[model samples]
Target chain A: MNTHIRVAPGDLFGDGVFETIHLRPDGPWLLHEHLARLVRSAAILGLPEPDLSELPAFTGEDIAVPGVDPGSDVPRALRIIYTGGRVHTAVTPIPPAVLRERRDGVRVITADLGVSVRRRPPWSISSAKSLSYAENFAARRWAVRQGADDMIWFATEGYALEAPTASVVWLAGGELCTVPPAEAGILPGITAAHLLSLAPSVGLRAAERMVTLDELVAADAIWLASSLRGLAEVTELDGKPRPHSPWTPRLLTLLGFPATS
Target chain B: MNTHIRVAPGDLFGDGVFETIHLRPDGPWLLHEHLARLVRSAAILGLPEPDLSELPAFTGEDIAVPGVDPGSDVPRALRIIYTGGRVHTAVTPIPPAVLRERRDGVRVITADLGVSVRRRPPWSISSAKSLSYAENFAARRWAVRQGADDMIWFATEGYALEAPTASVVWLAGGELCTVPPAEAGILPGITAAHLLSLAPSVGLRAAERMVTLDELVAADAIWLASSLRGLAEVTELDGKPRPHSPWTPRLLTLLGFPATS
Candidate 1:
């Protein structure tokens, strides 16, 4: 956890981009995909493309030093933050709340985000994961205040958009679906996209389509997908109880994520 | 400028609130009003109430120190930034761009911000001037890229909203008007509100009304008011030139701002 970086006070305005990568014993998981999406997010923010060569490679040697507990199955979390002044990375142990959600699942509530897909400003950075995350943090805080673990946001038109920090993915019949990023003008979720790419390999059809809250609730199973959290199943929607799905374990394994507690 | 604050890397998320005040030879202008608004903005972001007693006071004597040209007519800028870590303040020279806009005015374009007044999320931080200003910066950048100095945002229902960093105020005959903050769910502009309060002294009626873009375009004159910039007149709207209004200079003077270049 020896992180080093210097930035001006103005950088706190969230006028930057960042990526969170799952750090396994082997190395940073899906490093290339995360880097690519980081570049894309920077472009959306009108920032200069980041120099990938300048990034530090996550070598497994850090976890394999003599006397270290290499036998431990727990994975660390890696975060790369890039502001105007500097780029830096940090590694920290994943919090217990994330593990709890993965194990016992979470209750999720849906609310209107009040954003109009048709009226996105010309410089709209909605599709970019910029650092201006107060609203996102506020949404999660509101969920916690409401006695829920997380919340899903919907467009003003009533289309299910995304979670504050994750992408919404669901299983409906034989197809695995997520909201189309381009159509909804939301940040394209790298983990969700990667999982959708592997859907065919798992003998499941994948589709990207706009869905309503009602339609999402009627789905066979729902999960909030992200790089670090991997996949946290939705055990309840609003106040209604939802049955646990057997597919949760299978999908976690498919994504190279640990399924056991 | 003497600044002595040090913060950690995690402080750059813009998950806080800020206020910019006009520093005059007399003292920091509108100090109490600015402090009050800062507290309100912090409340919107769910931050603990700002302890005003803990803040540094920028007295006129502090600016009268040797080597600080005592006769300089240029107004200083005071900014207060509060985040999860701490609250801090700084004094700096106002940007040349802000002064230029005051003298020569600005050309503005109107774009739909795509947010719904009635449907803001439970955790919506729109009414607060939170530190997560990436989108605000991006919106201004977008306006600059589109061949305009700035932009006026419209709600999804076609009602004229505020600017990226300023409040929209327009003159209609004898009435001075601004958008209603509660009805529109916009950040209440302290400067605009103060100006409206002074309208009666200048023999003009003042009001807060929900105006359409068309109505804004048809106004006698329109200006975006903020702490740093004072007031910037919108000389052009959607590429159409507007007739110069005599009240621009009169109002600036009425509000105790420098009336000439």
Candidate 2:
């Protein structure tokens, strides 16, 4: 499953878009939402509209794995990539760090991304799920080196934008809130958006708002939400440790994930 | 040759670095300088130091073409790519647009990159010549779509930076200058830096300083410098047609480029 795929040499220059979806025995989670975002990302990059007809076949190959071994909890991640030269799709096991952060929490840091949200250009790709993710990876690496698990980026004006690989979600004043993706010029978080939509079912109001770093630090709880990690709670921020949030397990349940151990 | 090369599927994710060098019948122009930048870029991305013993052999294969045909002026480009899994080297003909711009000059525009240089984060990779170049390509595509050949990015503080794929060079008061790459947080341009190093021989002083957009527009002459396109004069800027400067040909010649036709 960890096999390499062929691509035109030029296609590897990061002039493309991609999407990662959580795969399960039943089907890919939020399949349509992920597909819609993939098309949106492609348009942002001016790449030709991708042909997604082959994706269903690729995802269906191991949909019945759980039936053979009900107790096995294997994690599979499906990636669909669209480049100037071609489209590539693959499924691989989710990495161990992702599962650990989801079950156990993550320590986080804050850093200025050096970008000004109010001065965005017409060609800005920050909102697109672009394949130019080296900066994001490097930011995370820097956080790891600083003895943290992830780093949340902020605009120059002191508002939290998003984490390198996930959307920032928090609880404040009895409401579930996440950063407004459009205003922040970041990728719209599929998991965070869906969770917000379901917040009322759990007796909480949902919101998309700009939260300052101070406000975020003062919030009841914080988590980084993405496709693979669902929500990795911010266990420690800056240098201060926070007690685990009781809502972590309840929200995981609402999202149809097994309760955090 | 325009042939495809196989790569690991993960390699196409743009978590790598690359250098594009101008290939000549005699040798790759600025081979050592390009390699030195390659190492710097790799270190910025945390990739292992690359092995370069094979580059000389790769460049030597077709170095004797002039003896077989004296009138050949085919432009070749050599690419060296180092990814998480492998190193790839290839030689291909230079794109016609590159040659055209070098010969006929270019029309350009300036836009805010939305980055605040004064608040750069510790992990910012803006200086790395990374494979994560979707933003650069997108920026150029945007300029081209707006009826210009390329765009020069400026910082939020109004100082001119570099073009998406090239360095901004200008002449002012008998001195040649480019934006200080380290201070500007940009890829150190091999062509621009080398041209400046050779400025004394051409009776011009070399300097690296921060220049505002107004100052750049008021310069005696302006050009975009890169490996393949040695110097493309700024023929038009912000929709205002600039008269071709006689120095365009002289500077090109100073940079070891043939006189513009």
Candidate 3:
């Protein structure tokens, strides 16, 4: 957590993009996909493509070195930030709230994000994971103030969208599904996409389709997926209690994440 | 620009607030109003209140001294940024583009921001001038790609809001007016406010009104007011040519900015 980084004053305006990877005992998981997305996010922000050649390799031996942490077995969060001027990398312990949400499930609510899926502006950066995250944090804070663990956003048309920092993934009739990112103009969720890709191996079908909030509420299970939390089940949505699905532990194991978080 | 700044990794998330003052040969302009707005922005972002007692004095002698530029007559942009953890100050020359826009008028376009004026969520940060400026910059880029200099945002209801980085002010029938910030849910413009306050001195009536795009188009003159670019006349809007405003120089002079920019 103690590190020194320098950036120009112009960089403070959030004209950048970032990626958060799960640093595991085996090294950073899904490294290639995250890096590729980092490049895509940078382009969406109109930033020059970062030079990946200068980045340190995410090998297990390199990760075991003392500069970041001296051979610590505990997993860490690896963050790569790219402003137009500099590319910065930092590693830190995962927040306790992420672990809590992953283990205990989340009390979820639904809020109208006040956006129309039909009329997104041409310069829309919703599909890019840019660093202008104040609105995202503000949304989460508003959710917490409402006595909820987290909230999901729905468009004006009643179409279910994603969360502040996670993608919505749900199970319905043995099919694993997530909202189509490009069509919905949302950041493509790496973890949710990876989970759906693994669904067939778990004997479940995978698909990307738009779902209304009411239809989503009727699904067997709903989870918020991200790199850090992995998956947090929506145990209670909009004050309605949903019984824990038996598939929670099975899906976590399928994703190579410990069910205990 | 050669100074160094240190910040925590968490500060990169655009969770802070900032103020850009038009530094003058005498001192920073509208110091008290800018500081008050900075505090208001901080509160909207849920950041701790900034302590003004620790801020440096804004005296003419201090400004004339070498800490910034000894005996320099050129105006500088004085920026005060505040994260919950720290307050940072920096001085730098204004961008050449701002000066160019002020001297020469800007070609502006109108776009639907896709945000509903009536449905902004409880945690909406639209009124707060937070550092989450990626979308703002992105919107302006979109305008440039469309062969325009800048863009003005309008609500889905067709009511004009504000520019990406400036306030929309127009003159009609000897009246000076701008969109009401609180009602429109946009950041209040410091320069626009100051100018409107001095409208009586210029033999003009000042008011706040929610104007539609059509109504704005019929106005006698339109200008985008900001700290650095005191007043940039919108000479061309949405491909339609507008006559050069004779009041541009008068308004700029009234605001204490050089008529030549």
Candidate 4:
């Protein structure tokens, strides 16, 4: 949605952190988890403590929309942004492309991000979801130009890291696994963490492993997990096509996401 | 100076480009060059061409500042920020720290940035001064925490790339040299470029060369060049003592910057 707000000039320099939470009719999905992660991100950027206790007080009545019934069950995206200047929150309609990726799959490619996970600078902000997202957006634009839906990044040592805005999740030998965020120096994906926690309920095992790109390509199924998209299976790797996964529907059900394509 | 502006929610995403120009008593320094670079940066971010024709008409009188004379010759900083939402220009007083660095030089350290020039992604935004400056600020903070004033980045290949917010320049064998912007995949430094053009007039040759960190350490002098800082000599690097260079005053004179502390 097109929304405007007054911001200090210093706030535009990207010295801030943000969290995008999926909004449900009941309330914001994983609201506590998202808020806690927001604080962690703020600390990483050296920002002062943010007062988020006032967030839950905001009901649909507090925000005015032209035609949106905030009380409706339609899924929305709530963005909480904090900088040294001030704290801001915005609610926008989830983009149609995200929905499409969830329904259909995504064509994915692997690219070397040229960074060594072991040698990240002392003050590196890689683990923080900072507002400095120009590179992330640029990488996605490059993927689109190359006829791919998204891209996964690998480190110089050939270890899979993460996607620009999501975590890489795969299934191999009946085990659900994701890359360990701290070891990989990548942002921890809250959705991926939540999904892994539910794996046992679905009679599956969960693990965190560091795998080479070659090993990842050999996985039984690969998917990118995030808040908005839920999960987008990697139907094609590089240029090779892979058949649809049988677990996609079951996992969607386990995650409480509607899989009505 | 602290200033407030009206911005869109999207503007806080750091998906934009900016230019900081030195405002002189005559006018903004290198106004046309900075504007042209801003357009180039916008193109790199896939943003539409920004109309900057109205910027030149802004005189200090148009902005209200307390406890200051608009007619005075005090130097100011003219920051032009452009995002998907709109174009904003702000005039603020130069920070005292910047002036101190120019006069007394700076202590710096060398750190591996973990990025390889050979493997830069197809959509690398390093050539554009986008608003993703969190990493830059973080690097400086890291330096300060380590008892230094700034930091320089070296590639995994052992070649000196550039500083987080400035370009690396040095003097050796009677020549003024800096890393070539395109070859090094770094943002072209307007100040460094303009200074190189005046090297011949000061009896020194100008050249672009890729040097390793070891080679940089052996140079007669090393400096970080940028818009606001102009040039800050590396007085101490990686705990090694570097005597004040005799060329510092001469080069500052050639660049039309005051050498007086």
Candidate 5:
């Protein structure tokens, strides 16, 4: 990716939508799903339909893209950012910390998002992956300061919603579950949703649930799911240690991530 | 000002702070107060103190800077955007719509912000002029689509909080009042505060108080206060027409804005 891009000052105000995809040797994982979401997000912001014809087209199964080095074992992060006026695409190397988190798991905390799910503004854009991420970044920074690697956000009344940058996924009563976006009023997570759809193949039932913090703590296993991280096991939640879940490697491999990690 | 700037891809995420000042022939309006708030906002985001020493030093009163035209009658819009890593400043001619809004008044509507002031996360940046303004822009876009010129945001319980890019100020009984930033969890409006401080000189008392939407509708006169527009009287509220407020001109002139609009 270029180190710098030219932009009008107004473009810096975060009035845009973007998606990050895991670019493996076989091309971007769930590329179609991510593109579809980008369009939905743009509509929510009243932005024009993005012209994505320039992208390589594929059907059903993922294929090796012309851009990727087939010999390379490491995956890249492919990002597409679209405002009303422009679309920018960049391919970047995945960070070492992301890989490390997936390998060793993360320490987590829960915080109230201070928003009312029932009273969301008629024009609320919280469900879109918009570029206004200062608060999201601030929340993550606060978690780091509190000595946790990450945090899960809940609406007032104690319902677990999502992490600052990931989706909350857990195993409870032999079912694989994630929060439903519309009810939770959060960005729909492509990684988590796709993982749950594949749960049946791993002998697990898929479900969408609204779990409270206490309920989440009592789950069999918890993970934060995202594009690059795949699934980062929650090793510790709210200062309490949890045992390693054997299902971590199984789910990672199911999502096309390196299972050994 | 340059038409475009160089920026890293990460910089476009809106993890920054900004301030827009009304740059009159006498220089930036409320320059000191704006700078002070800018620092306070940076601190809220855990950013380092912005190196503002490069800006022309001024004390007490605004002054004509070496960069502005001495004979120019029109005031420019001066802006400062800081993102911990960099500070950028620009000066440009004010837009005609801002002038028109000041002169003709605006048709306004109110919407629920869906946030809880009491339950707000400890890392809330609502009191800071952070650059994550996608929702603010989205709200304004929604208002325009509904055929209104601007909007006032309210907390879930009907408390009138603020406008998308301005502060809520109104005349109640004999007092000139604006919403208190700390209580409302809105950004402290430099223009509104300065206007209130000068109210006593105009034979009116100043105050900061919370009022509900029903109470706001009954106000003698209401105006949205900001740096560029100065004061935009609400000509209509929620489809109900309002008579022109006689004090609009008086307040504009007092704030160094042209009384003639």
Candidate 6:
């Protein structure tokens, strides 16, 4: 959907926060949670919390059209961007490559992020998903240069932190686990948290733990979970091949995400 | 100064390098050196060297306009922004506050940047003035919150690094000095380098040294030098008041900049 807003040149500085929500036929998935995180992210950046109560309305009629094929499923992505002056929303089609990665999985590598876990700045917003994503883009680019699809960043203390755009989730001994965000000083992953909340119904125990690279590699299965990509299985890690896990498809279906090719 | 360009949404990610130059009546001050550093900064960030030849041609006719006061005696600020897709340039009038800081100087604070000096990332782009400036803006905002005009960052190893948007230069026992960019892992300040190069003619010694916070505070004079704000002296550091230095005016004159408010 086309949307427009006027902004000053200074607004392009990337000192803001954003959230991307999966839009489904049922409605925008987990939108309230996304909005809550957006406010939390803004608070970390010292920005006033955005008011969603008066947000411009986007009706179903605006997104659904008469000529659209009913048989073909319509998948939409909603992005809410809040800077100093403006709060904007836009909708776009899910990228083909993102769908491809979900189907075939991704080749991932691990790298030392070289940031001190104990020495985060007084204004450190690492735990908040702010819009200053150049470093994130750079990390991913570095991984691509290393012949991988994405990267997992570790703290200087040798603890697996998180991916540039996803949360590290693994299964070990029937327990589904992800990093403890506060202890690890990472952005809290809503998708991973939601999945963990549902783990008991799936006959699995859930946990948040500080994991080392060795311990992560030894896990039964590993996945990088995020909102848009849903869950991308780690098919390979650091040039080493990993055996395919049957749980990948099962987890995707459990999350109400389409199994795409 | 109202120039516009067509850019895709992805271009706003701040994945680029930029430079701001002082545009004098003679032309853009130190144009060649700025361009060379732009290329060097791009190299550090692994970005292709921007083609300087493709820069929007700036002619006297372009800036000279009817009804505009040519006798205002206001200096211009030239900004060059280079992303993966495009290199753009724009000119604007320098703000009065920046000019006042250059004249009357600034109150400064020093803080630990919490970055390890020895453990620079393998793909570290610290020496590049990249566009990932959210942290830099955050640093300045921090200083403002702390009741100071700006801040000087110190590495975890205790050596004083540069400020968020400017280079740290100090006078000590007749020697002019700054932190060596390569060794300290900081973006080399072109203005600081140019001032040091001209120091010998004024019978002053010039050198690069790794200095601690104490040594910086004890220096004869300290200044945050940049293109837009020529030299803002540190009247106070970390809330401790400092005696006004005689060298502040001398250095400003030596750099062909205004020495007083």
Give each candidate's fraction of reference contacts reproduced.
Answer: 0.78, 0.86, 0.77, 0.93, 0.89, 0.36
Using TM-score as the yardstick, the better of models 1 and 6 is: 1
> B180 in model 2: Cα distance from truth in Å?
0.7
RMSD of each: 2.7, 2.9, 1.9, 2.0, 3.7, 2.7
Candidate 2: TM of chain A? 0.94
Cα lDDT computed for each candidate against the true fold: 0.84, 0.86, 0.89, 0.87, 0.87, 0.82
Over the stretch B1-261, how does candidate 3's per-residue lDDT look in tens digits? 234577777788888899999988768999888999999999998888998787778666544323555566666788888878667777777788999999998999999999999989889999998999999999999899999999999999999999999999999999999999999999999999999999999899999999999899999999999999999999999999999888999999999989896
Q: What order do you get sorting by lDDT, best first?
A: 3, 5, 4, 2, 1, 6
Using DockQ as the measure, the top candidate is: 4
Name the top TM-score candidate.
3
TM-score of each: 0.94, 0.95, 0.97, 0.96, 0.93, 0.93
lDDT by residue (tens digit), candidate 1, A169-261? 999997999999999999899889999999999889999999998899899999999987888999999978899998899999998987965
Off by more than 4 A, model 1 = A1-5, A61-74, B1-5, B61-74
**Candidate 4 lDDT tens digits, B94-212:** 88899999999999999999888898888889999999899998888888989999999988888999998889999999999999999989999999999999999989899999999
DockQ of 6: 0.47
Model 6, B74-187: lDDT tens per residue? 677778777765677766677888998998889998888878888876777788887777788788888899999999998889998899999999999999998999899999
Q: For candidate 4, what is the DockQ-based docking class? A: high
Instruction: List ranges where model 3 is wrong by over 4 Å.
Output: A64-69, B60-69
Error of 5 at A163 (Å): 0.7
TM-score of chain B of 5: 0.93
The candidates, ranked best first by TM-score, are: 3, 4, 2, 1, 5, 6
Candidate 5 lDDT, B151-231, residue by residue in tens: 999887678889999999999888999999999899999989999999999999999999899889999999999999999
Off by over 4 Å in 2: A58-73, B54-56, B62-72
DockQ of 1: 0.62
Write down the TM-score for model 6.
Answer: 0.93
Clashing pairs in 3: none
Error of 4 at B108 (Å): 0.6
lDDT tens digits, residue span B1-261, model 1? 344345555666678888888887678889889888889998888888877887765775565323457567666787788885467776666788998898778999998887877777768888888989998899999999989999999888889889999999999989999999988888999999999999999999999999998799889999999987778999999899988789989998987888875
Assign candidate 1 its CAPRI class: medium
